[model samples]
Every structure is written in structure tokens, then in C-alpha cells.
Target: MANTMWRRGVEWLAAAAADPRACKWEWDHGEGIALLEAGRFWDVLTVPDRLGLLALDLLWRPGLPVPGPTLVDTAAGRVGFFLPPDPSGGWVGSGLRYAAKGSWVAVPPPYRSARFLEWLIPPDGNGVLHPPGPLEKALREAHGALAVLAPMCGR
Candidate 1:
């Protein structure tokens, strides 16, 4: 159920990106990632921002109202959107577990706004992002990049 919701959200974001006025997408090399910020939440591009990357840490308190995405400092530098654990208790949690690849920290409140969600895309060995097989693959690859950023969860 949650997966479906997540995927649908991604589709919607992608559609929004397709919409000329929805989101402004750009790639940042200094940050070693791609970013997409929309004026509203639930935008499809926000899906990658939420699922593709990892927070510097996972200090988010469960059951707390996120209001929106959160930003945190990370070994990779700064990552946005520290998604909370999915209520489904499925691969979502395990998929987001701290890996040696990236740092995991809390997303500060001031940064927790609808416009703040940004996707982090890792570059390949050639320092280029390779398109993955599917949306899930793209998202996982983004997460893998996050692992490369921190490589160790401070927590």
C-alpha cells in the first residue's frame, strides 16, 4: 500500500516536472547531486528527493508531524529531506538504514519546508550519473550515492 503510494507520488512528481511551470530541475557538481525543487509538496520530483537520498542521520522522532521535508548536514555535504520510517514496516526502513556510504543526521526544522525537498544523485566512476533501469533503480542509485557521501552513519 505504501509502496503504491510512494510510486504514485513519484509519477505525479515526474508529471509535474514535465509540466513547464511545476519544478525547476538542476544538477549541482559541488554538491555531487541533482536537485529538483517545486513550489508545492506531493510533486513527483519530490519522490526522488525523498526516496533517492539519505539524511546525514536519522534523529527524527517517530509519530512526529514532519510538516514537510527536513535538511541535515552529511558527510556527503548537505542532503535534504530526511524521510521518516514508513508505517508499513517493510523494505522502506531497511532500504534507508544507515550504510557506510553516507552520513545520517536529523533534518533541522527551519529547513523543513515544502520547497526544501531535493533529490541527491551520485555520479558514476566517470563522475556522471547513469540512468538506471527503472524509477526504483534510479532511486536506489541515488541512495547508493548517499552511502558514498558519509560512508558512516554518525549514530
Candidate 2:
């Protein structure tokens, strides 16, 4: 049930990505891995920015209302549309994770899910975006990447 809701949210975000106003954020190396290592992954992106590459980290907290659809550019791809917290701030947890060929060679499981959301492309010559695929493939890839890198990471 929760996963279904999450997927719906992602779809909504993808539609929003069609907006011409949306732009790419920025990417910081190792940030996604760091989020995975830390349980507090929501710090990466929030619930409104845009669907693109974001370079900076946004702030969020329990009971703190956010204007999100928080989009950002990560090393892996354009990752965003974070999960918002419940009304009580319970489940405020979120992680817009990103992974690339080498840097993401080894990431722990805890950060697999929400950390990575969507892979996007510039569908038109306009600034609008075309986000592709579900988080499942990316999660699976991360899982696979970790398996290949884990032996070297000594875990």
C-alpha cells in the first residue's frame, strides 16, 4: 500500500517535470553514498524544487512544512520527488539517492529505496524534462552495484 502511494507520487512528480520552469539542480560526489551510510537521508532532497540537476542540499524537519517536489541532479541521474512526512511528522524519512557506474560501486541496502527516484531526459528542446522508469530498476541496480563492490569494500 505504501509503495503504491509512493509510485503515484512519483508519477505526479514526473508530470510536473513537464513544466518549463523546472531546471536541473547540481551534483556533488559521494553525497548519495553518504546519505545511505546515514539513516537520516531526507536531508538530500525535500517534498518542491523541480525535476532536474540540483547542486545544493535543502533543509527539512518534522512539523516543518515544505514546498517540495524536491528535485535535484545527482551523479547517477536526475533524482527527485521525495516522500513527504505524515501529518504527525511520523515517516518524515526520505532519501533521493543517486548512483553512477564507479562511485556507486558500493552502497549499503538501507539507502536503496527512496534515495533514488527517477532517471530523466530533456524530452524537448524546451527546458521541460522527461523522467523515465521507476525507482525499482535503480534500486535493483544499486543492489547489484553493491554486490559487485561489496567484496572490495570489505563488507
Candidate 3:
């Protein structure tokens, strides 16, 4: 079931990229997961809103935790992982913010390490967020695949 949904996500992304009028999108390659953002509301709305894209399950994966209180801004067409609060005023942990405008940012260390830095990419191809155990290798593969597929999609 999960695999089916995942594959559908990949297919939808590919179709969106193939359409010349499809809005631009990007993703961040970070510690826990890959965060994706589509520049226009329609592009992103087609996924979570209309298609009901499921959240990637990461419970069994060690060193990679599912982000808490994830927020998707349907209006701004942005998605972000918010850091939980601590006893102190400061954020207890780090989080990620991906804007459809092609900007990705992550809260720096103490909150999290440099590994959490976001990697931006066009919204095409397969965008899988492999767990932390094999993050580096997975990212390389995903990025390479996206690069090859992006041009064909008119990205």
C-alpha cells in the first residue's frame, strides 16, 4: 500500500513537470526526510489536497525521526517542519522550511547538524526521503535521477 502511494507520488510529480505550464517546485534533502514544495497552489494542491498524498512513514527507521507538527501552507503553497518547543523560549529542536519560490532553509546546529541543510531541486522525477542510515547514498541517487528527468519534463 505504501509502495503504491509512493509510486503514484512519483508519477504525479513527473506529469506535473512534463506540463509546460506546471508550476516550478523544489525539495530539500535533509536528515529526517525530503521536503517538497511546488511554486503555485494548483501544483501542490493536486497532491495533498486533491490526491490526498499520505505522509511518509518513518517509524521503524533509526536515527531518522518523523518531523512533528508538520504544516502545509495551502495558501502560500509552502510546506515546513516545525521544531518543537523547549522549556526555554528557544526552539527545542531544528526544522525545515521549503518555499515554492525555490528557497529551502534549515535551522542550524545545536538545534540540528549541518546534515539538515536543505537541498533544492525542481519538482520532477522520484523524490524519496530515505532514512538517515543511508541518507547520503540515497540523496545522490535521487538527485542524479531528478537531474536526468528534469530536462525532459521541461524543468
Candidate 4:
């Protein structure tokens, strides 16, 4: 089952790459990461680690729908959530960056860790992506929560 999931994850990721063959080759040849084009299969919504961690906590509570694939760049102190493409490109918030249309993203293999990057929530191999509405709400709520805690932390 693990192997099947691993292969499916790889296939799912590769299908989003500009050249799926090359992407698979790179992953198969021990490259450890594949640079994939954004907006092909999904758009990436990135946030600072400070806000993202809090948002994740809220999203993961029981009875909430599971969020799509999420990743973190430890060295960069950023977290990225995969969401379906938004033609309007209307996502807007403090500290939020949308990668879509022409942007690129470095993605680690679903089953392994990479330097400075790792999957917080690995892709489920079912092409699921976070819905923009819920994500925006979670992020906004997270921002508000952080604002409340900031003074308490002397920030």
C-alpha cells in the first residue's frame, strides 16, 4: 500500500510538470526535488511560518475538511498550501503570495524529506486541492489570532 501510494504521488506530481518525463527522471535519478510549474495542476498560496503554523492548527481540528498538500521551507520560514487555480488571481492578504500562471515552485517528493523543505501535508494522490474560500478564512482567522497573541508575547 505504501509503495502504491508513493508511486501514485509521484505520478500525480509529475503530471503537473511541464515535462512529466523529465520530472520523473529527475526524481528517479535521486535529484530529491522537482521544480514544477505553478497553475498547471494547482496554485500555491504561501505565507510566513508564523501565520501558517497557526492556520494549520485551526484547519486540522476534527470535523474540518483536510487541507490539500502543504509544504514548508524551514530555511525560508515559509509555508505553501496547494489550491486549485484562480483565474481572477484575486487572493489578497497581508503576507500572502500567490504562485500561479507563470510561477514555478520546488516540490519535494511526497515520501521523503529534502534539505530545508518538507511536506507538512503530503498530496493524497487524488488531485485534491484546498478551496480558496476556506483557506482565506483560515488565514484571516490565523492572522487575527496572532494579532491577539502578539502583545502577550511582547512582540
Candidate 5:
């Protein structure tokens, strides 16, 4: 059952690529990572690791809805959150970068972590995504938390 779910998840993720079959083939053939186009199935909102981690914690707390797929680029110190495509530019500010329309995100296979890329929250193959309302709230809370801590750390 787990394997089937994972396969479905992989398939779902690959659908974001320009060529789904080729993308899946790359993953199956031991490719560490592949760049998948954004703004199709979903868009990506990227933030600094510190801020993103804090928001992730808040989002996953008891009774809150689980967030969609999240990716971390360790080498780049950034985290990407998958959200429904919002072409009206609603995802600007708070040091967040919106990857919509023409952007691409590096994705590793759902079952494994690539060298500098890892899944902070992996997709479940059910096509769920992070809703904008709660996501913005979580990010604001995270920002406030960091603001409080920054002074103590002299940062």
C-alpha cells in the first residue's frame, strides 16, 4: 500500500514537468534531482530557511491543516512551499519570492533526498496544496516570532 501511494505521488509530481514521462525516467534512472516547471499544478513561494522553518512548525501544529509539498535547498538556505497558483501577485512581501508563471523548482524523488535538496514536507499523491489564507497567517506569526527573538540574539 505504501509503495503504491509513493508511486502515485511520484507520478503526480512528475506531471509538473514539461515531459512527465521523461521526468519520471530521470528519477528512476538515479538522477539526483530535476527541475520542474512551476505555475502548472501549483506555484512555489520561497523564503529563507529560518522563516520557513518557523512557519512550517506553526502550520503543522495540532488541529491545523497539513501543508502541501515543501522543499529545502540546504546549499542555498531557502525553502519552497507549494501553493495554488495565484497569478494576481498576492504572494509578495515578507522576504518571500513567488515562483509563478515562468519559474522552475528543483524537486527530488518523493522517497529520497537529493544531495542538497530535501523534502521538508513531501507530497502524498492526493493533489493537496497549501492554502493561501492559512499560509499567510502562519508566515506572519513566524515573522513575529523571529522579530521577538532577533533582539535577544543581537541580530
Candidate 6:
């Protein structure tokens, strides 16, 4: 089941890259596990944590440890992205977050160093976060950022 869902995430992300409406950070959340607790902020769980939580059978109504602002919402900026808290006071933006395994970030390929929230959240400015021009531009420079990440993700 996890493999199926993971595949869906990959497919959704691949489709997003070609979506005319898909901005710089667009993604489909129906492809991932639903959050036990919904919020703007979320912690990226490691494989062990994920297994442990899944074993709970999640009877509590409070919620799950998963992430959210799922791609289910078609409205602009409805997507939410969360990063592991840093000195930057956790994540301060909203969009399709990448909280894969042990990291809450994406390298967009070629970048050896991993970035926490900087991938989606800019260091400055009040410009609209969606379709982050800088991130998109950087990815474009590397022949499509998400494209490079897809194969690496083993999707």
C-alpha cells in the first residue's frame, strides 16, 4: 500500500510539472498519508517514525503526524509546505512541502548540500510565495528541478 501511494505521489508530481496551473511548488497530496493533526507546520519523520505511527492504528481523533494542505484543494496557494524547524522559526510559507523520510527539503538536483526550508521559502522579500520565481528559475537552470529529483527518489 505504501508503494502504491508513493507511486501516486510520483505520478502526481510528474503531472504537476506539466500542469499549466501548477506553479513552482505545486503537488498532489492525495498521494501521501493523511495527517493525524492538520496544521501549517509539520515535522519530517524518518522511516522508523513512519512505521511506528502506522502501527498505532491511529485511533485518536486528534490526528496523525503526517503533513498537509493537501493538493486536494484546487484554489491557488491552498497547498501547504512544512520544513523541520530551524533558527528561522520553523517554516514560514505555504505550498506543496517535501517532507521525505529524514528531511523536509528537496535539492532540485545537482546541489550537494541539502536546504531545509530555503528551497520553498525565500530568504527575504514580501513577494508572493507561490510560483517562487527564484526556486523555479534555479530548477529550470538544471533542466527541470523536479525532473531530476524524480529518478533519484526511485519513483
- Model 1 residue runs over 4 Å out of place are 19-37, 40-59, 66-76, 82-155
Kindly list the per-residue Cα lDDT of model 2 for residues 1-155, writing each as its tens digit: 54554444433323333221221111122332222211122212222222222211212323333323333344345444333222233322234343221221212111122254323321121222212223233334454565677699897
lDDT of 5 by residue, 39-110 (tens): 888999999999999999899888878888899999999989999988875877867899998988889988
Give the root-mean-square deviation of each candidate in angstroms.
15.7, 16.6, 17.7, 1.3, 1.2, 18.5
TM-score of 1: 0.26
Tens-digit lDDT track of model 1 for 1-155: 54554444344433323342222122111222223332332212122233433321222235432223333334433443322222332324342432111222221112112233233321111212111123234456556666666546541
Model 1 vs truth, CA RMSD: 15.7
**TM-score for every candidate vs. truth?**
0.26, 0.22, 0.24, 0.94, 0.94, 0.21
Better of 5 and 6 by TM-score: 5
Candidate 1 local distance difference test against the native: 0.31
Regions more than 4 Å wrong, model 6: 19-66, 69-155
Model 5 pairs whose backbones collide: none
Candidate with maximal lDDT: 5
Task: Evaluate candidate 6 by giving its C-alpha RMSD to the native, one decimal.
Answer: 18.5
How many collisions per candidate? 16, 21, 0, 0, 0, 5
Q: Give candidate 5 misplaced runs (Cα > 4 Å).
A: none
Q: Number of clashes in model 6?
A: 5
- After aligning candidate 1 to the native by TM-score, how far in Å is the CA of 43 from where it should be? 10
